[model samples]
Target: MGVSALAEGGSGTSYPSHREPDGSIGIKLLEASSNRKNDPRAYLYIVDHINPGTRVSRRFEIRNTSSSSQRIKLYPGAAEIRHNTFVPAADRHANELGSWISIDRPELIAPPNSRIQLNAKISIPKSASEGERYGAIWAEVASPSVKPGSAGNIQMINRVGIRVYLDIGPGGDPPSDFRIEQLTPGRTEVGMPVVKATVNNTGERALDLGGQMWLSDGPGGLNAGPFRAQVGTTLAPGYSAPVMVMLDDRLPDGPWQVKLMLESGRVHHTVTGTLTFPEKPATWGLPALLDSFPLWALVIVGSLAAVAVAFFLVLAVRRLRRRRRVAQ
Candidate 1:
């Protein structure tokens, strides 16, 4: 089903927005939210090699574009790098690092065209050991409820966050690194081909692992997929996990070569290997004439060829005799 919207005064119509007069709300990490285009860490705060027992602060801005007022909620949650993605913990407080973050203003009301600046303090404990921790400060806006008698009274909310990374200790540098132990090519439960990379965290710090992948099928090096490595695949020191990239589309069934490039902060690594598909090439019920066969099949075809040759020779001899009789 489709729906339409009209202007309040029946003057003109356009798509709907949560706010009246199509107003909007914006959240930015200082100047802007992460465009995620050129700068991967544009909206993220990176406190590199900062010693424990120290304090730091992070600030952000939220603006209301609508004519009416809006209430914005803020909170902090633990985050991890896994499966080539940035994954955050649930609303519940879980990560020990997240406990160090203190949000002074949890809620604020912003008038139309107003920008509100908020601050959060990171108070690291003196006993904090050396390693890296992941977390995020999130801002959210929720839509109002539906009318009294509607099909569903569900409300929609949109949220965005700024990622935070802290390195703790006196000489706090946990060998910012990890390694790709192996690349195994196989299929998923649904029979889709996937290249699974086994990775190990060799450093003392937890690493958020993710990367890009490229695949070439067959001898011509025909490119298939540039699948990305799993993001937010977090691994503590002496830990391991499987980072998988699924070939979700249809491609020629053959041997393929996969190249992967992985990175965490300043650390980056690239690896390449071969993979074979589990499924065979599609055949439209055609006979297995070109397919590999047993010796019995070969012998049967040879026998049929010899029988046809003998029958043709006998017919030629009979025709020659008939011609001789007519001439006599």
Candidate 2:
């Protein structure tokens, strides 16, 4: 996580800044330079987990805090998991683990406070199956070529990545499967009240869904709330994702029995859904149709609608006195 070079009177070259473990200031390249004994070069990078025709080579470091002469570059991109976080992919490239990675050197110049080590290698193609694979490990710097009356249009490429977790095996970790495939209790075209659900990854890794919901069958020990979902939901495997959970119009229109729960490590899951709420619409709006009944059934249907409105106001005042005595 480092990149900052737009140069000139502003003096470029960045993408590497650290010193946090209580010290402070750590955002020069996204973070990860926790001063490993005074900046052991952004504390190195890659993390792998073998088994699958293995072949590794990790090595990374690139410093040149500038004094002129700094042209770094390197590649391997593709890594995303939106929402459930784990981003990394700016100047994207390749795809499947950046095509199995390979970056010995594509460009470098350093000089002036120098420090440059490369080597990225990662060959796993014995059919390469199993699970987990994301990529990233960039480090570019060059920015200061835009003076001609500058208002440019493009040219502002400052990079700083570092995130690669390639695991391929049935070995240690890579099994967080998934499932919660259906909950759908709707209303949201304006009538907002929701609770959708669907999350099937089915194992082999990639997930970031979260959960919580509660409300049950109570009668005198009332209790109904604790709804919290809409977490960073990522799910990528057999792919499937959608997990809404909205409801709150003073909830309570019967048939509730919620109680959902969910997790992703050591795997956990709980389910029990049913949240009905549809029948307050006759163009609804009498305090939402008396707040959807049940307070002794809206006081016995409002006392039988006030005795049928006093029997239709005694037949409309006896037919208005027989049409005013037959138009006297």
Candidate 3:
């Protein structure tokens, strides 16, 4: 069903608005509490609307209607709608809920005729595209008195969701985005480290790239670049460029953090990687050389060395016997 129909109280839409075949219906947006005295109602709150990031916090409320207490389970679910149909007006789909939004604490117990509130926070990706997204928050009732899982139980699952309409605008210069991929020791010595960063144009527009790498108090703690990148400058959407940062070998060895910074448009994004340096090489010289080779090669070389030693011992014994025979 179209998002607009679900929001405006239209009938015969594919999306169900309250009243499931099993007799469960979503809580209406403006419905009063069934437990008049206890305030058994549900509401939704959003922290931000424009930037389309996930770290938004959603809060819900439940009230106990019975004389004793009630236990409630809040299920966090999510569903995605296409970006095209999202409209900011009230006429858009308001109740087309997504899966239950995930909550840190899933269950709660309310005291006799008491009210309870629950909150869930989700991490939104910065790369979320601009568009209309729809999903629901489900509050399921689990009190034993409600026939515990019965369809007609006073314990009910209420659903509410927001229609997120994000518009970042079309056709602007793309933003430069960068992330650190790997960092490690480049040579066997205690120093000399190699760091790698992947820079990309995550936005819809092309980006002019300025990037740098710096070591924070560790192996080869040196700063590389604000390099003028040639490949990353005109990156199309989702294209990436790999840049390597090299540090001098004489730098001290220890735990180190590497940072990569990229500038595009008016913003800069920094990505980081962590690495540790060992006090010494695990092995050295011939023993280390053999250890570094493949197991089969090491076995063959060791076998040849054993044969050569046996042959030399046999020849020395024969020569000593011949000398003794001449003396006799």
Taking all chains together, each candidate's TM-score versus the true structure is 0.59, 0.29, 0.28
lDDT, each prediction? 0.62, 0.58, 0.41
Cα lDDT of model 1 by residue, 117-194, tens digit: 888777888888866777777676777768877888777776656666666778635565677766766656666666
Residue-wise lDDT of candidate 3 within 102-196, one digit each (tens)?
56667776576555666655554566565423444444553245456777756323433332212232333233344323334333443444444
Candidate 1 Cα RMSD after full superposition onto the native fold (Å): 20.1
Pitting candidate 2 against candidate 3, the one with the higher lDDT is 2
Predicted model with the maximum TM-score: 1
For model 1, state the Cα shift of residue 133 in Å: 4.2
Q: Rank the candidates by lDDT, best first.
A: 1, 2, 3
Q: Find the 10 residues in a row with the least total lDDT in model 2.
A: 6-15
Looking at model 1, residue 69 earns an lDDT score of 90
Off by over 4 Å in 2: 1-49, 56-74, 77-82, 89-100, 103-121, 124-133, 136-145, 153-165, 168-173, 181-184, 192-195, 198-204, 208-232, 235-328
User: What is the C-alpha lDDT profile of model 2 across 49-152, one tens digit per residue?
Assistant: 66777776766566666556767677777776665455765646646677778888867777766566666778887778876676666667656667677686
